[model samples]
Target chain A: MQRVSQRPTYKTIVSVAAAVAIVAVILALGAQKNFGPQQYGQLVVAGLGAGAIYALIALGFVMVYTVTGIINFAQGAFVMLGAMIAATIYGDASSGDAVGLVIAAIIAILATTLVGVAVERLTIFPARNADTLTLIIITVGVYIAIQGVGLVVWGTSAKAFPAFTTLDITDGTLRFWGIVLKTQTLWIWGTTALVLALLTLFLGRTLTGKALRACSVNKEAARLMGISPTRMSVFAFGLAAGMGALAGIVLAPATRPIYDMGLKLGLKGFVAAAMGGLVSSPAAVVGGLLLGLTENVAAGVTKSGLKDVFAFIVLIAVLLRKRGIFAAGTDLERP
Target chain B: MAADSYRSDTGTTTAPAGNGKESAPRRATMAGVVVLVALVLAIGLLEAFQPGGVDVSSLTGGVITFDTTVRIGILTIVVVGLNLLMGYAGQVSLGQAAFFGLGAYSSAIFTTRAELVGIGSGLEGRWWWPWLVMVLGMALTGALAYAVGRPILRLRGHYLAMATLGLGVMVTIMFRENLGLQLDTKDITGGSDGIPGIPRLRVGTFEIWPIERYYYLVWFLAIVGILLALNVVRSRSGRALRALHSSELAAETVGVDTARFKVRALVVSAMYASIAGSLFAHFRVAVSPTPFDFLASLELVVMAAVGGMASVWGAPFGVAAILAIRELVRTRLDLVIGGAGGEQEAVAFGVLLVLVMIFMPEGVVVRVKEVARRWSR
Candidate 1:
């Protein structure tokens, strides 16, 4: 028992050592003579905003995976749907139309939630007993179907929506110490913090949230305790869909929402979740922020076309280093 | 020999009882051969009978034609490898297209961009250079698969899928960025432009041109792939894969070396994809990153799923069925609906995959065969 307990400590030490080594390398690169401090600051700001969005979507992945034991590939599609639906609703709104933007966000979130529920009922619920690989493939199918729907609904053109603020292109933008920032970035950061806080509170205080947690911990026990696992799983999907939509709606102002944007965004978030070992919410948030920062820094150093290349490289490196990525704290003993 | 025990362990239970209750692997291989011959004949007859552009005015303007059959043939070769990995080894990989792209780009680079990389002023003009490049491409991709499959195969289910997805995306980014590999003037992979004007493959005395002749070549290779896969499914390795698929622990207990079998399946599948990709490069006389993206990977999985994951003989049927439906939707459904855009085929495939997985996980091949046998009785 002592040796078994000590093994994970040794492994944890190695994991931390490897992570620190990577960070040291990144820091060394940043300290180069040609790399300006201001540029590094800019990268950090952009990374924070990007990481917030990733954390929101990663929360969706963790929520669904914990409750239903399935990785919802359509999670990214939900993000696209939110952005596109909101854009369609708030099309060409005037500068002062913040109320309209709010309404559109509400509608988009609700609509995406409905789609998530429909996916669970239509595709996932039917093949609930199938193997894990089959379920993942099914989600991939759902993702494709939703992308097709996005193409049909919005056509191939990209769409842009008004941000939550009245921040204009010039006067409303903030300039602090030669660094330019947008009001939308503030909104993104605030919304992410608000979601995380609310989620933490809900899970801690609310009976329904606790039931969902219980479902994640043990489905049969929850069922025996008179909570319907079906309802919890459905609720989990709905919650995840709402989070994904929120991320999309917030992100659309920063970058125009296109029909196929979900693929990359979803993949990034999944990578973040995997970094958390696919189970921990706080860890996923940290993972998202770290990924966003590292990718931004790497992109700043290299070409921007390889910005995403950094994220995948991190994923592979982390996956290789951590043999317990799929085992530790993921309820692996359930099966 | 242990194929029956493997099949039974997997709970397929759909294998029919023969007149003499003959061995399952032999029976399955014989069926595969029959299907291969029938497919060849059917494709031949279609090529001979289908109205060409000169015969029918409507057909002249359409994009889907006998060339689509050739595309299906090429894709059939790739999907056979996917079927073996997913069906027999019970491992899920979404990076098959990455291997395919690697093969195509390797062939393209060796044959066309050799001079750009300073490998060949004379080798590029050789008659057998492309063939050598193709073989080298297969070997490289197989080695890559072995390296990647080692650690990733340890992760079960969706984690493995996500890791492979990351791999696929990385491959695309590398191709898109050209890996910073530059010839004094331009990027090596040609970036989005890819490597165009790859020299067409040649036989001893003749260049393989004309769509019909290339179609035969591709189908011939695809048939060979099918036979090779059937042999693998009938061999001891096949049973070991099936055993791992059913229960890795049980297989391990029986001294099956589950990890080695898995890596073997992945290497075989990767080689199969690489060969198909080499054919694709030669046939198109060009190579690009566009066709081998994440979507292509998903489409390959869809082909495997729609055909039947656990059956080796389902690859061609899956390719033909999915492509035909896609062609129909792309050409005809747009005309009927009038406003659905060009993504209807993707939508149909998505729906088909879901429905098949939910209701008919055995896929079209196994289910149809079972029905036919029962009806004959």
Candidate 2:
């Protein structure tokens, strides 16, 4: 038994060593390009900002998957809805209207949360007993439907969303040394940290959150214990949707919100969630940050057009490694 | 071989039935062949008699030209392969379009830039060049599917689905960005514009062109593809696939080699997409990345589902139904919604996919058959 256990530790060490070597090589390559610390700092900052949003979105993925055993494709659509609705409510907020923007953001998140609940109730809940493939396809359908509706309502034009700042929204950047940081980036990080703290506390302390966790651990056992799995499923969806909406609204100011922006962001978030084996929220947050940093730095070192490609490559690599190391036991194990 | 076992299993329960049980599948195959011949004859007659082709705009509320039929034929080949993989093998490939795009871009790049690719200008305009490229493309796509499927098919359900989706997006990006090649002089894949003016396919001196003649070639290959899929579904490997679909562990316990069978199914399906892609490139006389995007892959899945994934004969019907709906939306949606663009069609497809999966997971063909059987009784 000790020998069997020792194998994983050895494998983990080798994997960690390999990862370190690869990072060192990439850093050496970046140095050869003659880019100073300033450029590197900018890339790190930008990556972290993007990573924070991805972490928020990844939490939604982890939340839904643990409870429902579904990889919700429509999670991206919730993000899109939050951004689009918020933009619509606070039209042309790039000039600054702090109170108006806050009101719009609140309304958008609430509406999107309801949208998530409705999606689960109408589409997912009805077919709760169906196989995984059917459920996955259903979520995909929901995504397509939402995106279509978004197009019809908002048109194909990119909407303007203001950076959250007390000063003029247009001038929200802060410079320290040679590194420039957007105030919105700070907002994104702060918001993500607050949400994470709240989430940890809720799951750790609250009865409802514990019930939800119980359902995720084992649905039938939770049901036997008198916890309604169905209600918990609804709650999970709504909570995830709210998180997705928050991520989108915050992200919109950084990059102008388009109807189809969620597809890419949602996909990246899925990659992050997958990095956590689709089970651990904290791990997914770490995955998101790592993904963001790697892709940003890689793109900075190479061609920008290949930026999106790196996320998928990372996904494939992570999946392969996970399959190799966690082959015998994992959440992915089938009965 | 599996068909014989299936028949015998049923034969034992009804020994007195004799040859009656065996004739059912034979009859279905006969009906399929007859339908194909009839379709060909009807289209051939239409072309010979009405040179401009008949328009049934009033009936369908949309004009389905010969061009549309050609498209249906091309898509049928892909969807049939999809049916075998998804329906029989119970594997989902959200990146099937990548294989199709690979086949297309292979045909496009090789033929258009034969000299550029250092294959010399000699074979660039040869009649057999495109055909050779098509076969090579299928082989290449199959190899890729094997490499990808080995690792990917190991991840069941949602993990597999997401992995394939990521792959499809990655491949599409590669096509759009010219495989990340920064050539200052000449553009490979022509970048976003893609390769245009791809030469029409030919058999010696006879050119397959003007839409009418091309229809024959497309449908003929499509029929061949259908026949091939039907054969595979009835074979021992097909039974193994069905077993794997039900429960991989059980299949493995039976010594079915589930992993190998899954990978084989993926490879076969990919080859079918490659063939269809080649045909699409030749027929359209141009190749672009847009048609083989993630949405296109979803469209293929939708077709497989709508037509009854398990039924090989349902491929053409599924393609026709989807294309018909798309045409309907294109033509008539503006009147209903006012200035409806691509949005209405997307909504229609999305709703249709959800409704179909929820209400009739077995697909419309099987449901229709059940209804017909009931009504006949």
Candidate 3:
């Protein structure tokens, strides 16, 4: 009885500690002499834009993980591929307008979807019955292989493309009250909101999306209901790749896409997904936004290089505070 | 995945039943030991035959060069610990390399920044200081791993992996950013250039230098690492780890301290990485944050997987196999592919990882041996 009673007390202490830490960080950042309220507001807005990208990627992570029960480490690579492919295609074309940007993005998304399906069919499908640890390792392998291919194709330099609908130069900045924002900020917000709405409708109203949801609920029962788990896994990967590509292409204009950029971005996205219980799509978006804001604010106060550190601290803290939130099923009994 | 092989090996060999059954594990372990001795001898012979160093071009067609061999020795030591954690204990750690980097950086700092750490400047030039520093580095890293693993081991599967990944990235960032500590506007972690001039190991005025002597020293430690790992897999704690791996809840139901065992595996593996890191610093006489980043951690996982997770004997060969592929690509494949500018190594390693996971999830060693046995019969 005492042991049972102690568990809740421990939990209460942990939650309280996490809350205090979050508040302390915000207070520390606000208290900095070099930072003014205007600067803080601008940082928050920038953090929101960056957080939206993370949310997009985290959504992809949630989709694949829900359906396939595998965290695609290659999700980040898809993001990189999306952005780089668009940049490369846009650079190669003589045309220079919004039409070229749209065409490039569609091509990049379609191509990345193919790569995602190939990854599943070639590496993941064969080891579907393996343990979760084995599946994670396989994803890591696929990630490495894809990154290598990217390195071979794009070399080691950072690549850039013009912002969507901007044609050639980055010359659109919006000033609101004392805060400055970019037009790309609007693009990120618009894309995320639009995607989330479409995703909600698809999952709630579409037959295929419902089938995919059934697969996530119970693979065996879903199979008995005449839905193929394999096909759903394939579809999930394709959808995730599409989402990742959307995030990558959208984010590329702000931060130049490099061959190895996917690793850090993917990790940050994973952090967000974990914080949101890994299964809830909307929660992941909220977690991503919160993580971005906290990281940017911490950087504003302390040092820029430690921003990733701050984000990871939140990850570790959230992970310890919660248990069994993300595990869909135990894969140990299977071969 | 490797739990089956380990159980069969140790269980079948040590049972005292009166049934007339040959001890397969004993025989296999004996074979493993013999092979390891043969490997060391082969290295000796190769070095003897080519006093002026082995031809790099000749070995480019999938052969282990001498330099590659020593590097593999160091890596094998680290991967053995990983095999215990991932293979036996059934845990995922994406940050083993960070522990390794911490070990290396610790040794580098202790040897180079003795005064900075407030150990006084008098012990700077002493040869024996490095040996003590290596021990300290291992201890400190083990403690850090223990502290970090307690909160993280409670997580299952992918959550555990993410937690560890975050821990690793944090370590790398700290190293790259010099621990955010500055002295007179200078970076404490050497600011990416890294700390150099780490003194080599010496025992009572006998110095180990010339790179080849360091080879024997590293291989000696590698053999010890392998033997120690085998012992752990066959012992009582080893049984507990295997049980925990099979099912943590089941283990707990049976009164096994699952969390304690998991943390033990993590800390032990971390200690292994720490020692290997110390050796790495002393061997190269420098410490850098580059090799301790996420990719290096991933590479370590790749090595362990290639070796077949539960097989202690398979890890060294896994190290050799992966290193040989890198050397082969560096020396031969890049020229043929019109120069991918060093990107081909990742390509080869990545392809190897995918193919190995798809075809031989149990690893190259166990699968190849099974086929060979079938063929011989």
Candidate 4:
């Protein structure tokens, strides 16, 4: 009975500590001579934008883990591949303008979804019996394969077509106190919010969405219910991959996408997922955003080396704080 | 889907499967090891016999067998330790190389700074005393591993991998920062540029001369390491580890202290790596802090994975294979493929990783399995 009570007490302390920490951070940021209200606002917008990308990638990580009980390290590579394919489509002469870029985004999303489907069907499907680590190695193998192929098709030189400066209608910085806020930051926030609204709908209010959720919750039982977990895997991967691709296209104007961009981006995304206990799909998005804000703010306020250090610190804290962030079986309804 | 693929034109009237499908190709692994060893030895022998090239070795004469043998001995020991951790224990560790570099620096500091520290400053110091200090250095390094491995190894799967990887990165950063310890009075750890003048082991005027001697030295340690690993794996404790592969939860239910086993696995693996580090410091006669980062850890992971984990013989050969391929591409592939020649090797290895999946998913040893199956048939 004492042990039982202790568990909740442990949880309460952590939640309280987390709340205090966030309050302290915001208070501290507002208190800062350099980061006044306007700067904090801008930071939130930028953080949310970056966080959405991380959330999308985290979605794939959690979805795959739900069914397979293994983190697909290749998820990040998928994000990278999705972005690259999208960039390639847009690079072509047929799609060069704003309208064309939008079309290219759709084409790229479609192409990337197919790639995810192919990856599931061709590689991971056959190795069901292999150890979890072997599966990871296979994904790492997938990562290496994608890198080579991506590099071969597109050279090592970084590509940033359709620059990161679109939709800058605000076109000026918002100043209040000593803080500074960029117009693009606001644009990114608005765009991310719009995309997220659509995602929440598709996931919470649709039949196909329910099917995908069911598969992640329990592959075998979901199959018994005629959900074809394998097919769900394809679509789950597609949706997540598509989300990541959209992020890549959106952020392309901020920081250009490159072949190797996925690895680092993927790391941050996984951290975000883990941060949220891979719970409450929206938590992933919030976790990603929070992580981005924390890191960026930390970097701004302190030394840059802390960025990497900050990730592990958060990982250990959250991992210790929560149980089953990647708790399997959330994708499907409870039996 | 393929289960019903064999429904032929006879309306799927199949003969009841005779005595069920025989077990997977387990017997093939034994023969595969033999052939693979022979192939490796043949290649080694050929290379040893036909070698004529300008050596950029920093040593005087730059062709001593002792120094050359040292390099081989060092890498073998390090990779062997790695095999114990990743291959036997089923832990994906990329920190082996980092631990290795730490051991080297630890030992290197001990030997190079004895006089400055005012402990014993004369010819009375035995020639092999440097090695003795090196052992102490390794113990210290192993102690560090022990502290870190216990709590961190508790993390399941990739979380543990990332944590350990973080430790490696942290150590690498610290190693580079040139944080030196003042031993008694002298400066140890060589700071940034690293310790420059490490004396070579000499036998009077007749030094252990030539690169061939180093080859012999490496092979000797390699044999010892193989025997040690073989003995441990065959022991009762080894069975406990192998059992984890079968069913972790079930193994725990059966009275195996799973966490203790994991920690033990990590410590044992750390000791091997520490020994490797000591050998490297004494042999190379110089220690630097650049090559022991996360990438090296990844390369080590690649070695164990590509070789098919849980094999003692495969780990060393895997190392040799990766290094050889790297060296081969750097020197030879340049003429065949244009550009700086550096990127091609990584590209090729990446491609090889993918091909390993699609083809011999079990790796190159598949041929041996096939031969054994034919015998059985």
Give the chain A TM-score for each candidate: 0.90, 0.92, 0.90, 0.80
Instruction: Give model 4's docking category.
Output: incorrect
Model 1: per-residue Cα lDDT at residue A62: 90
CA lDDT of every candidate: 0.82, 0.84, 0.83, 0.61
Worst 10 residues of 1 chain B by lDDT: B1-10
lDDT of 3 by residue, B239-352 (tens): 788788777768889889998999999999999999999999998898889989988998898888888787788789888888877776776785687754567788788878
Clashes of each: 0, 0, 0, 14
lDDT of 4 by residue, A1-335 (tens): 12335356765798789879976875675566466666666666556667666766766676666555656666776767766776777674432267766677788778777777777777777765555555666666676666666666677776654543443212356666655655555555665567667767876799887777677677778889888876776666666666666666666656666777776677777778777666456667677777787766654454444455566566655554434343431321110
Question: Clash pairs of candidate 1?
Answer: none
Q: Looking at candidate 1, what is the lDDT of residue B48? A: 61
Off by over 4 Å in 4: A1-11, A14-50, A82-97, A161-174, A299-302, A320-335, B1-75, B104-133, B169-211, B277-290, B325-340, B355-363, B366-370, B373-377
Model 3 residue B195 distance off true place after TM-score fit, in angstroms = 0.8
- Candidates' RMSD to native: 3.6, 3.7, 3.7, 8.6
Model number with the top lDDT? 2
Tens digits of lDDT, candidate 1, B1-377: 12221142112244433346676656656776787778677656666666452422135355457778788899999999998898889888998999999999999998877876678578888889889999999999999999989988877677778788989988988898887443437668989889898888888769887777887899889888988887787678987888888888899999999989999999999999999999999988898898999999998988887788876667877888887788778777867898655677777788888888787776777778768779999
DockQ of every candidate structure: 0.51, 0.49, 0.50, 0.15
- Residue-wise lDDT of candidate 2 within A28-73, one digit each (tens)? 8688888788889999998888888888999999899888778899
Of 2 and 3, the candidate ahead on DockQ is 3
Top model number, DockQ: 1
> Least lDDT summed over 10 consecutive residues: which range in candidate 1 chain A?
A326-335
Cα displacement (Å) at residue B330, model 4: 5.1
**What are the per-residue Cα lDDT tens digits for candidate 4 across B1-377?**
11111011110012232344642222223453466456445434544664454233322133222333345446666666666676556666756777887777766666676655455755324676655666776677778878877777666556666567666766665565544231334345554567766665544543443545545545666667766775566566666775554556777989888777777778777777777776666667787776676657767767665554566655665666666566666666757866545666666776566555545444443334446669999
Better model by lDDT: candidate 1 vs candidate 4: 1
DockQ result, candidate 2? 0.49
